[model samples]
Target: MSATVSPDQLPLQRLYHWERTAPNRVAFTQPVGGGQTVDYTWKQVVDQARRMAAHLQAQGIGAGDKVAMLSKNTAHWMMTDYAIWMAGAISVPLYPTLAAGTIRQILEHSEAKLLFVGKLDGWLGMKPGIPEGLPCIHHPLAEADAKKSYPGWDDIVAKTAPLAGEPVRPADDLSTIMYTSGTTGAPKGVMHTFANFMAAVAAGLERIPQNEGSRMLSYLPLSHVVERALVEHGQLQTGMHVYFAESLDTFTTDMQRARPTVFFSVPRLWVKFQQAVNHKMPQKKLDTFLKIPILSGIVKKKILSTLGLDQCIFAAGGAAPMPAELLAWYSKLGLNIAEGYGMTENIGASHITTGDPDSFGTVGRPYAPVQCRIAPDNGEIQVKAPWNMLGYYKQPELSAEMFTDDGWLKTGDKGSTDAQGRLKITGRVKDLFKTSKGKYVAPAPIEDKLVMHNAVEACCVTGANLGQPLALLMINAEATAVVKNGGKAELEASLAEHLKHINETLDPHEQLDCLVITSEAWTVDNDLITPTFKVKRNRIEDMFAKNYDRWVGMRKPVVWHG
Candidate 1:
């Protein structure tokens, strides 16, 4: 609640102040061999960053010049990000797995003159699409020491002198420009300023408090704005120590290593965590045991200790709405993983829960100066925040469309405000559908409901022209096993009975009129799911359009993906 920001300090200046106050305190950690740790102190990070800044500035990089970082979550990645800001360059981040075509386009679009590629995937040739001699730096992930191939990130810093001067950043200077996944079209650069990041930190503090002693893990792509804003920037603000996981495969072991006091994750990861717990203890037995209070405590503690969350204050899920059941399950075990809601335009922390069980479905009230209103047209959420972006990088027309004449950002999301003034987002305005019965249907709530059933892995609820109701589903492997164990005729009969049981609980219109089962998974490789694992409904609907008739007429789940 203290609004005492000094008017003249640049971001680097503020960050340096924290490092000075805690010079010997650990600032970051990364995994090493033999279950050992690789750590960086605050002073070391600041000194190295200054030298890296000197390296970039000596190469003629200056204020507003774009610098792109292409790497995974590692110590070098963070060092390079700080150096970009310390030297007053706008940072552009590229996903390591992205298409070379997309990489080329972003590089050309941002006019990024210097590139840093880390821990290269061997499958993608060393010089696949990159123009030869592009002043590129490469750090193989497996290499323990920075090498001569690309000015081993550390040796270059060790040789250079730290640049020193008064900080010159203004709140309005462009800080970072992150690219969208381009599901709708080619990716456009989304811009943010120093004020955007600072305001986000302020808003986030109001919802979820972090202090100098907070310990966190860094696993998500720093290329993404959410993790960058919450974990990276938050660390700069409070001097919290950050740790990085080895890779996607090592997430479990890495969590055990970090034992983070503060955890943040996307919905996809939240679902996976729940799946992990369920995999260890089957749902039916776990649920039946939870009814007895004393036994439930034993179960909850065992699960929490195993997940390395036995001492966490809060674990948060964001980037997409979470299935409510997941939160309740973890909450029962004394793990409070609250859901947060915000988009890239809002600097990542817009609304979040601060306990109070009744607010489960909502992403909570506004954080700090952020204001929201249910827009008069179709009840889409409208917001105004100091943290809102300057606009899309170089796209004035699209930027103009994003804001109204009066300055509110049209959120493009539909929701309602409860009497308590908390917001509950119902669906995206563009996602609603009209059934043949002349009634409007919101598929999101239905999808959320269907996925809660034990048989479902994930489901897409959509109904167009010919349908009463339709759901495309990927059922759980355990459920599939149950069906296969029974004879064919018996499997069909039992599944039909299950549908009747589920329909009895739904209103006549809400009942699913058709269901299609699929054995195949939707993953990043197939272009069906986002990095955060939300299914692209438009693409899924298009894939199943030819068999719309079968979906509408069926009474039991049908295998469509096979």
Candidate 2:
């Protein structure tokens, strides 16, 4: 059965519902230094948002004005979004890790009336992007130095009168303009309405186990569509308790504090967790212990407790394709991570696995109310749903191009559907590269295999116009530590063996020629990866395509690139 949405289910309506019925319920838990934390109740959240909304109105922010937020996920981030909506303005969220040039482009293109700068790692680098004379407010958690440079959040809230009465927006009113984390080209602003977000949340709640008091950890950048919809909108719709992670260094500590019942993460972090576990105990030894029925239960409980996922009733992985091997590994550890598929255009609500063992490789069936199909000509996956974005902001022509003549959103991913309607994404339509032998190769599947080894952190498979494809690999922390301790040769041998094993399973044309260990790291700062840790294939081509032939010519299974 398809999911249905009602006007009462709107985000603001839900916020009002909780404020009246569950005023004392803890809405957010924010970690401070020295193992300290701060909590906000439903009434407190609404009260502060009301004050901020009045302040915004006083500043001339009216209906449809774009108010952008530049910060990591925090309680104030949520409060700021509510304030923007309450003031009848559309919210624009920028990824905290964006480059200054990109930030300027979005702010300029969005015509944002104001920017709210909150928690950030590189505020100094991002500060220059805000246009001069542009009104700005620094959140309570903004960097100490940056906090002094702008109007503080607390001061404004303290002095301003709370906006009287509940200021409601229409369900059709535009809620947010989410900029895509560009992997192929320049980012596009995806426009979503309040109704659209509510519909997506309605569909999600139909399947995912979430309700009032369901705990969630909001560490993924809320700028992303999935995190915003699932973590923010999910919390509103269900009155769930949301917790914020302080920093990367305190991620484990933060997880323990929240002990979230609902968790979502990308493929990279899942692999890292696996690596961390293997680093402590060899996988083979763990497998041996798992064979003992009595010991297996004890072992799994201990592992889950250590990772703070002991209470995780529903764990999901998205933003990128998850390795099937990784899924099996987590399943073996008693944590069934349901892999889902979606994008910024869909509010990141589309398909998700439902714990079917046979659905391991596929992303599973479309959510209730989401219709999916494969295009006959290109095999690109297409979807139609109530939650689909209204259109791209201000880019009418491009927005029109994103849909089919029949109105389905073109996902640009090539995949086949199983008999039961599950989707198995083969690769992106634009990510395919033709070799000198004229056979086109898809890199995502091969790249997934390469990351299964604990030594490899991130890798890209590309060798367009070359006889065979080759991979650019960046070793993980453990491998780097090992190499620094005069174990480079041992690591090289291990990589060579891993490379050969992967190549043997591929078709002749799809087989990789060699694995090049890159000296430079692929990072968000380098424009080599998106904030979500998905590699930018176009950027990879620009940076390393010239070295493909040279590495292949070395005639070794593994080649170190300086």
- Per-prediction TM-score, please? 0.90, 0.99
* Residue pairs of candidate 2 with colliding backbone atoms: none
Q: Could you say which candidate leads in lDDT?
A: 2
Clash number for candidate 1: 1
Q: Give the TM-score of candidate 1.
A: 0.90
Compose the digit string of candidate 1's lDDT tens values, residues 10-62.
46766678666888988889775466678888788888888888989999999
Alpha-carbon local distance difference test for all models: 0.74, 0.92
Q: Which regions of candidate 2 are displaced past 4 Å?
A: 1-4
lDDT of 2 by residue, 1-562 (tens): 2224687888888888999999999999998678889999999999999999999999999998999999999999999999999999999999999999999999999999999999999899988898998999999989987788899999999999999877788888899999998797888999999988888988888889999969999999999998999999999999999999999899998999899999999999999999999999899999999999999999999999999999999999999999999999999989999988999998888899985567899999999788999999999999998878888998999999989998999998999999888999999998999999999999999999999999999999998899999999999988999999999999999888998899899999999889999889889999999999999988988988887877888899889888
| Candidate 2 TM-score, C-alpha based | 0.99
**Runs off by more than 4 Å, candidate 1:** 1-10, 120-133, 140-151, 166-168, 454-457, 475-502, 505-507, 553-555
